[model samples]
Target: MASQNILDVVVVGYGPVGQTLSILLGQRGYQVAVYDRWPSLYPLPRAVFHDHEIRRVFHAMGIGQDVESISQPSATYQWFNADWKTLVEIDWSSESISDGPVGYLFNQPSLEALLDRKAKSLPCVAVHQGWEAIELHERADHCELKLERVTMQDGKVTRSGETQTVKAKYVIGADGANSFVRKSCGMAFEDLGFQEDWLVIDLKPHEGVKLDVPDIGQWCNPERPTTMVPGGPGYRRWEFMRLPHETREDMQRPEKVWELLSPWVDPEQATLVRYALYTFRSLIADNWRKGRVLIAGDAAHQMPPFMGQGMCSGLRDAWNLAWRFDLVLRDVAPPALLDGYTPERRPQVRAVIDASIAMGQVVCTSDPLKAAERDAAYLAGDVPPLPPFPGLTDGLIVRTQNSADGGIAGQLSVHGQVQNHGRTMRYDEAVPTGFQVIGLDVDPQACLSDAALAALDQLGAYTIGVTHDASKVVANRVLYDVSGKYQQFFAQHDAKIVIVRPDYYVFGAARSAAEANDLVGMLIAEIGLDQASAASKSHASAVA
Candidate 1:
């Protein structure tokens, strides 16, 4: 019943997604209030893999090294038949645009602890534990949230009769699968109907002892499909599919777990960290935003763990929303810019969900005959390779009139090392993350008109010239492409100038300075900066 000060954002969960969103907003000096029902961090591991793109996000948050310290780079993910014959092998060790291995494995609990510490350390972020959001009301200009303090004892939660009211310009439900905020907002999940129950077991081998196991692999045995992968630096995880005759309760028993692990290791060699039954399902929210209240992470989408992308997708959502929130909160863009969120992210998430389901179908084939057919198809090269992950197709990205020739509008921008002032560092570390007008061999500032340049400055955009010619390198302006990635990227795209969004997605690219100026103009108009700037000046005059 007590009133509280209005904040910029009220995040209704303290999980990794919530923590990430809060930290991003707090770093930008926004007042963020984060609430969680639990009193402390979850002690068990859940998600164990993140891609290089998410690693770049960690770097943007200034924790790239800390995250790398707790993670192990995944080399390859293999699928094997019942006879241990390799059916497929995905090379996760390949370098990506983020300039690291394609994927990594980490302990979720450790990551949460790191992110929680970072979020709380920011003066702009207020973290409240043991507070459950009871109600959310979206007003014309803001939203009101009601919270109640609760205590957990013996695996039961009890309300303490303490209540508080807080207001925020926006309310984000980064809550988990059963999100109360999602339910309150009347959003429904469109289930893709792919579901399977599996027992997930985490094990920690005794120090100095080694267990014989594939680093990361899926055993598509008709009897029981199994997954063996690293849980982190010093942990291992095994997942066994539940057969038709098995019950969830039976699969979670410690003896049953050890029986399943008998092929790999025994109790004497390793300690069981935790075991639980998880029903992997593919689901996406019908809507991500309902007025001033929005949902993200597991609240917006869920997919089978076949691709190990469930957590990665959620983190991407946080990163995508954080930059948009910053622009909207600062009044640099109209509120309608928020409308681009669902359209841009939904299709990409759906693509991943579909891919994961397709993979699950291949791995979860329990019938011996079907499994044999699947293996034969894979061995015979009859199955097509999985398609590359999709990019934004329906959002704020600029598309050519002929949609097929959209260029690299939605593809990820490359990040490579560059030399500036006798120092070599990653491009992002040298240039802060934002809208970047990067010229491959020309100066972006020289390419744009006065009006366009001023607009870029107003939007806090960075203009940099990158060239392979070392003589062209200038302090804080022109950078030498030490790794040649910039040249290669531009050459591949046939672009001399690229306009990258704050989230590292290319807005558009051009082959000439004139085209580049037009591209910048398109960006300014698309984001409605001109309208926002005029409104701000009008308001200032009225106040005077």
Candidate 2:
């Protein structure tokens, strides 16, 4: 056992979510300590899908190039009936607000490995593998974690006979579904009444082997509900719903795997990388935060993999919480700001889970008559449209019900290419982090009153005026909208100015200059910017 100074955050579980949070914090120059049970990276592929939103997080993490290198864009995803008729289709390759494909297929192992390397590369991050959090104690201002090292022999766990204690200002549980921190915080899960066993198999084709497999489709056959999809480069995956009479052992047999995958490709032709039975269920934590402790990722929610949002949701949680932590840790905002995380994320996650469950119900039917009815309805264009990506509805977002009243609150802002001083880059790269007051060919600073301008400045918001004309990029603050997406976005909202939060969600918008000042005023009052500033000054004075 050894002693160390109190860190900014002690993250339990160095999975994707934990690693992401650690890297984000470390990048902000905060000290982070990560604990995980495994001695090294987990080589198996579990989640093989990521949406554009998660890709945005990768961009924030400075790993967009690595992600793009190892990921493949998904094409149309189709649902088929027992007879292989297309019941419904979703354009997975559709453009996202982040200016990329809506969905991507990737090997989870490679993604995690890249994240691990990135997190460890940061001087502020301490990645302690082979260490597990055994206990957690929550204090008024900090959290204490008891960690231990365990030795394994022949895949069996044994005590390494070593233990240590670490103290941090906050603790995050990204420790998968069976999160110790979630349990330690005494949170309960509300089951969403969806649970089923499915067998997942990952296959990698030998170099230069041309193996035939069905397009990414959900076979809604009552005989055996199954999913067939490409698993990024050099890989393929299939999921089979277990029948009533089948047991876990029965499904895990090599013969059963071959039997299930036989329809797509002969198992003998491709290499069997891994196969395992998983119980797909829908559950969300009753509470995501308690005292100084919080949970994210699989520890907070679990949804069926039909929508491929399981991992994406967790990553979103990490992204959302990381920004909030940055503000709170810097004393720019009160701890109450963290209160918005659950209210904002829970609804989004619930919507995703509900959609996944509904999709699973449509694809997991064991009745032929129902499947036929579904097929007929879809063919008749009577089926429900695929739900749009969920947005922040009630948390920290400003909104107005009246269409005549301007407000794009709670919605995510669009990212597009921008040219600043002859350098072309994404809007996110050009604009500084924190709050951003963006205008369409107009300077938002001209709209704010002196008090409002002071408030905005205190919140660390900067104004960026974007113009569609390339000649308008004469100043450092005025960017050229290279793709015209920003212009179109403002026109669609009928807004002259928009207030974007650091996490890229639209806080509010204004249709006029006066209204922009009013919006800034409202934000200052709503978020208690003045009070925070006063309190911060008082604290600094007291410390001096």
TM-scores, one per candidate: 0.96, 0.94
- Candidate 2 lDDT at 479 equals 83
- For residues 354-429, what per-residue lDDT tens digits would candidate 2 score against the true structure? 9999999999998888877888898899977976777888666675722214446777788988887687887778
Q: Write the per-residue lDDT of candidate 1 for residues 321-391, one digit (tens) a residue.
A: 99899889998888888899998889899999999999999999999999999999999999999988677
Please count the clashing residue pairs in each candidate, in the order shown. Answer: 0, 0
Off-target runs (Cα >4 Å) in candidate 2 are 2-4, 152-156, 401-407, 531-544
Best by TM-score: 1
RMSD of each: 3.5, 3.8
- Candidate 2 matches the true fold with a TM-score of 0.94
Off by over 4 Å in 1: 401-406, 531-544
Pairs with steric clashes in candidate 2: none
